[model samples]
Each structure stands twice: as C-alpha cells, then as structure tokens.
Target: MTTDHPRTPGPRPTGATIVWAERVTKTFTTPDGRELPVLDDIGFHLAEGEIVALLGKSGSGKSTLLRCIAGLIAPSSGTVAYRGEPLTGANPGVSMVFQSFALLPWLTVQQNVELGLHAQGVGEQERRERALKAIDLIGLDGFESAYPKELSGGMRQRVGFARALVVEPDALLMDEPFSALDVLTAENLRNELVGLWEGHEAPVKSILIVTHNIEEAVLLADRILVLAANPGRIQAELRVDLPRPRNRQDPHFESIVDTVYGILTGREDAAVAAVEPTTTGGAERPAPTPTSAPLPEVSVGGLAGLLEILVARGGEDGLAEIADELNFEIDDLLPLVDAAELLDLARTEGPRIRVTDAGREFAAADILTSKQLFAHHAASRAPLVRAIVQALAATDGHTLREGLFLDLLRRGFSAEDARRQLDIAIDWGRYAELFDYDSGDGELTLDPGAQDAL
Candidate 1:
C-alpha cells in the first residue's frame, strides 16, 4: 500500500526563506467589464537550497503567480517579499526563463546571455566572462556565437537557461521551460538540469518552476504546490522526500505520483458527482448553474475514444499507464478524464479510471445509439449542455442567438474563455443531435427531440 502523503502545509525546508508570498491574489478586468480572478489567496515561500514547483491545470494561474514572484506583474492584493524586502518593481533577486525561448534572433547566444548583466550596467569584460561561464555551465559552450535562428529548439532553450543563470539571482523562476521541446531532447535537458542541481553546480539559491506536468514536478521539486482553477487557489501542498536521481519504476515514486493524480482528480475524497456538497453542512448542492461548472474542453470523439480504451483495458486502468502509453503528460489526459466523469461514463478510484456500465454501452453501441446515450447524459449531467438545452427549449421557435449564452457566460468567464465554453458546448450539442448551430448566423436551433432530453 502506498503511504498517504496528503497536503501537509508549512515551511518544511530548514533553509531561510529567500522568496515569500503571502495572500497574493490577482484579478483582471475582462474586456466585457467582468472581474476575473486569476489567483486567490495564494501563499508560499521558497527557502534557500530548495526547488519548488507550482503545479496545476490550465487556467490555474501558475504562470501568473510565478510572474508575481518575479515582480514582472504586481498582485492585486497581498505581498511578495524577497529576503524580507517588499518588491515595488522587477525583482532584483529573481531571473526568469520563459517557455518561448525569448531570445532576439539578431543576437548571438553570448549577447543574449549578457542581456541581463548589460541591463544592470555590468562592465564589458566581467559580463563576457560571466556570460561564457554560464553558457558553458548550461552545456552551450561552443554555441556562444550561434544565433537563435541557427540552433535547434533545445539549443535555443539552453540559451534561455544560460541567460537566466547568467544573472545568478537568488531565485531562478522558470515558466514551463521544457514544454516546447521534443520529448527526448526535453528529457536530456531535464536530466542534465537535475545533475546540475544535485551536484550543487547551479548558481541560483532557490528555484521555482511553473508546470502542468505532474511527473515533471515529482521528478524535480522538493515541494509541490497544486493550484485549483477558475480563480486559482492553493488546493494542496506536498513534500517529496525521495532520494536524488529518483527512479520512475521505484514503488515509492509510483505511489507519490498516484497520490498526486488522486489529488488532481479529486478521487482521494469521492468520485466526481454532478453536484458537489457544500462545507456549510450535508446540504445537497444545487444543480450546477449556467456558468458554475465549466465543461471540459474535449470533443465527443475524444471522450468516446477514452471510454473505448478503458473498456478494452478490462474496464479500468491507471491514469499514469494510460498517459505513458499515449505519450501524453498527465495534464493532457485531464480534460478527457473530467469529461468522462462529468457524463457518468467513468469514475476514478484513486488514480485508476473505471468505466461505468453506461460507458461500456456507449463504447459498444452504434452511432445513433451512442448519440442518444450521449444526449441523455449531457443534458442531465453536463451543466453547460443542460443550460443550453433548457434555454433552447424555453425560447420561441426553439431557437436563440448564441450571443445570449455568451453574454451570460461572460459574467463568470473571461471573454476568450466564454467563447471557448460556447464552442465546446456547441460541438457536444451538435454531436449529440440535441441542437444545430449555424456559425454564420450565430444562432442555435434545437432539434425536435432535444426537449425530450431535458
């Protein structure tokens, strides 16, 4: 049995705090005048000699919080302190490595690496020496004169690492630094970085990384902070006590990975139900309102494919095995997992997903029967789909402009997110034959039998 490493909050590392954030909340005004909270009451501290990973799904504002720590952007509330000093501008003690390999095409690797020191007005001789040292340290010794355009994606990202490390700041903040590279290349770089950190070669005092990949966090971080989405909050914090050069096949490693999966999927508590109970009491929660439960941005085909795979695997399988088989980071599978659970097609037991009887039937049925089953579940279980069906049912002539739903969604979601939700809903509705949407006219017309779904 795997030991339970549930979120144990507090400062576990012995080193003094190098970067501290307290109750940092960030909210942005949408184009439509709606207040969209990105981070909610987030608090964490990075101590000297530790690497911490901010892990979460998309929209969890992991990147936003990282930027707040780097002082690239100020939080709407709360405070960020570097070594007991409040930051009023760009953090002097932090250097950032971006996902996009933000290197100027016109500059060579050495020049790009020297940009930080140049901005700080370092003398040319010292800057050159430091830039060369950083370039060699990051395994880019011979490529100092190569432009970004002339290097492979991994090489450019190495340049990014060199540039960030060149400053030798107190904290190195990385935003999905390996996300853009190919798998093998990324693994090579990741292994090298682990080597550097474990060997005490990297100059940064503390490291903070923002990532959506659970395995990466497990493989790299001493502490992992899992953030929740839709007004991001620190849902959980876990410390990994495993030894260096962690082995993936080790039982303890697998156990910790499963524990994180359970946390991410909320399976440690209960299988996802259509309505979650409130903390006030055992009061039955209301059916999700129009914008309360955002639909997982997955297609009907993808959902059906996942169910079929689950059925083929004797009706269940570990989330980690499935992700590995498909060459997907665990995060890539979350939306489909969520969709399956939302529609009652599958349920999660810890980290394993078991197909329900309904899921088996849907996977085995013919197209028409599958559509019927999907329509039934989507209308009764999926909040957004149910709302769309209900709205069309009440409208005159069984039709309404899509803008009406978009306007309502905007109250809760950002403009881009509102559009994404509508698009996903439209796709699901059309696939289930519950409704037809004309993009040209921006109108949705309910099918004759769609009302029966309600």
Candidate 2:
C-alpha cells in the first residue's frame, strides 16, 4: 500500500502526560530462591495522542512493563504514574485488549462488551447503548448477538477492541492484539485501527501496545521503544518517519527493519556497533562456550533445515538476507542460530551465518548417519545435552529420576524457566537419539542402541 500524505509524529496532545514510568525495576523471587530480574531501571513516557510500541524479544519483560504501567502489577522499586498521579491500581480511564480473545463463550458480543460497564454498575439500557455504539464503530454492528466461537479470529479480536472501547477509556493498551490473526487479516485490522486514530474516532487519547513483530511496530507506532533482555531495559528508541498507510516495499522501511534486526542481533554492521550481540550479560563474551546457560527451545528440525538451506545456498548468507529469505524476525532467527552454534553445526560472525563442515556433512548424510553425527556434536558442544548424558551414564543407564535434574535446574532458574529448559532438552535428546523418555512412566533412560553405537 502507498500514501502521498507525509507522515510525521502523531498529533500534538492538549496537555498532561498520559503515562510515565520512572526508573522502574522489577524482580521476581523464584521458588528456588533465585532472584530473577525481569526489568531494570526502565523508564518511558506516553503522551496523549501518541501511539507507542514496546518491541522486544520474548523474556525481555515487555508484558511486565505494560502491566506495571497499567497498575495490574507493582514494580519492586520505582514508580508508575497515570496522568502525573501515582498509579497504585488499575485506572478507571484506562482499558486493555488482550492477545487472547478472553471472551465469554456463552455470552453474546453485546454482553461481552458491556461487562466492564456492568461491573461499574451502569444500567442495562445505557450499557447496551454504549456497547452497540462501540460495536457499530468498530464494524461489528451486526455481530452483537454472535458467540465468540462463531466469530472469526479477526472478528473475535474486533470484539475485544469493542469491549475495551465501550467504556470510553482515555488510553487503550493492547498486548500483541493482532498476533493471533492471519497476515491479511492482521494488516486489515492495523489499517482500520490507524484510520480510527487519524479520523479522531477512537475513544482513547493514546495507545500503548506491546508487540514483538518488528514490521507491525514500524507500521503502527509513532515511536518504537526497543527493549533488551537479560534484565530487560530500554535499549534504544526509533521514531517512524514514514507516511501513514506505509509501503512495506519502500527502501526506507526495509532499512529500518534491517537496522532493528542489527540492533537486536549485535551485528557490527547493524545500524548500531552492528547492534550489540544478544547477550546474557556475563563476561562481555564471544560465542557460546561449553559453560554457558541452557540453549533455547529451537527444534532439531529448524536447525537442520537452516543448515541445509545454507549448504544449498553455497554454505553462507548475510544474516539480514537470511532473515528476509526465511521471513523470520531477529528474535526468531537468533534462537535457531544459537541452537545450531550450540551444536557446532553453524557459526555466525559480523552479519553472516556460515554452515560448518559438520553442517554440510549432515546435510549430505542419510537419516541414520545424520542422527549419529548430531548425537556426537550435541553431547560435546551443548551444556544441557552433556549434563543429561553424563547424569544418565553416572546412573549406569538404569532407572531415571527427574527429581534430580529438576532440582539441579531449579537451583539456578525459576520454576517455570527450569521446566521449559528441561522440555527443550528432552526434544533435543530425542532428536539426537541420545536418550529415550517414556512419557507413561516418566522415565528417561539412555537409548541402549545409541549407547552401543557410541
């Protein structure tokens, strides 16, 4: 799509700041007694008439920061203010639209939209009128009596929008609102939303959305706040200077995407130092060594598929080029690269992801040979995989007690995190054929055939 009208910053607000977060820090104490820092010294301000997007990788605490601003959760230290007033609890003028439909399946669209009003003791007649107005405004006029299950995903999210808007909030907070929809539907919704804001039809004075999709951020927000992981903080900010109804194919838009990707991946050529490498903040490190933390939950299939693509493309491609080719954002691409590097199957430097000799060999090998090569490298190169194998060996490949591993994991990570990492390890182990897990009995045992092969 294209537009001739020049796009600048949003319309100026009449007065007062809508929301402000100052030196906000949040830390969670895990069941394992580990202090997990989610957000650290993060601060930002949202003005009336501004649409700001908080863009970051998962685990970067974007959602946490959003909740902090909404007063759904309090910061461990620091303060959140709504309109210069210390926000201690949810604001009556603020409303939220969740990513999930969060609709009552049994309730009709009109009832769903009227829920908040009903809670505030609005009369049924007034609530019905307001809900109908919102539904009509959002183009859901006829669907007021439809159930959630009968509505399409886009329609369901439109209902979410109507429900949030029915109360006429001063600010609308959306958490990845369109992520659940298909591409065309999402684009359509984005346009409708921006049109609402531009036409001065939306009830809210400002919008703050938390989203991980880079293109979506650039397309929608007046300003994009980029957050970094490992004690999430505001890493950088980029103001979108393009015209509304942006052309995705525009060189400038692609440049911004590349710049953001560079920023997130630590590529030296990236718009910043080559953007700082995605780090866990230990000793200003370089590459995954043997002692690093557990690998992310990238599938063996994903790693192998990327390696095969690189091999077919002559063993290497520029990181940004690969990202474009694979249609993956930096957050999604990094985990696959990290997983491959963890297995010594791929190496990345500067802006290039290079397939290693092992990667090429694996690409050419039969499935059986591929499995053997993967088993060897995974055992040697990945810390978690090695730990699982060693633990099994030390126990003589006999009975398995997950309690032992779970305890070890919990000592350093949160209960939820430990479980997620263990799940990733299980998938890796099974793919490498290094171990067998019986789901029925909850037993993890060394694969006797794999042991004999080794």
TM-scores of the candidates in the order shown: 0.93, 0.83
- lDDT tens string, model 1, 53-164? 9988877899999999989899999999999999999999999999999999999999999999999999999999999988888878788888999999999999999899
**Candidate 2 C-alpha lDDT tens digits along 383-408:** 77777787787785455876667777
Which ten residues in a row are the worst by lDDT in model 1? Answer: 1-10
TM-score of decoy 1: 0.93
Clashes of each: 0, 7
Per-model root-mean-square deviation over C-alphas: 5.8, 4.6
lDDT against the true structure, per candidate, is 0.87, 0.80
In candidate 2, stretches whose alpha carbon ends up further than 4 angstroms from where it belongs are: 1-15, 29-35, 121-125, 266-292, 318-334, 347-352, 392-400, 411-414, 438-454
Candidate 1 Cα lDDT to native? 0.87
* Candidate 1 clashes between residue pairs 3 or more apart in a chain or in different chains: none
lDDT of 1 at 94: 91
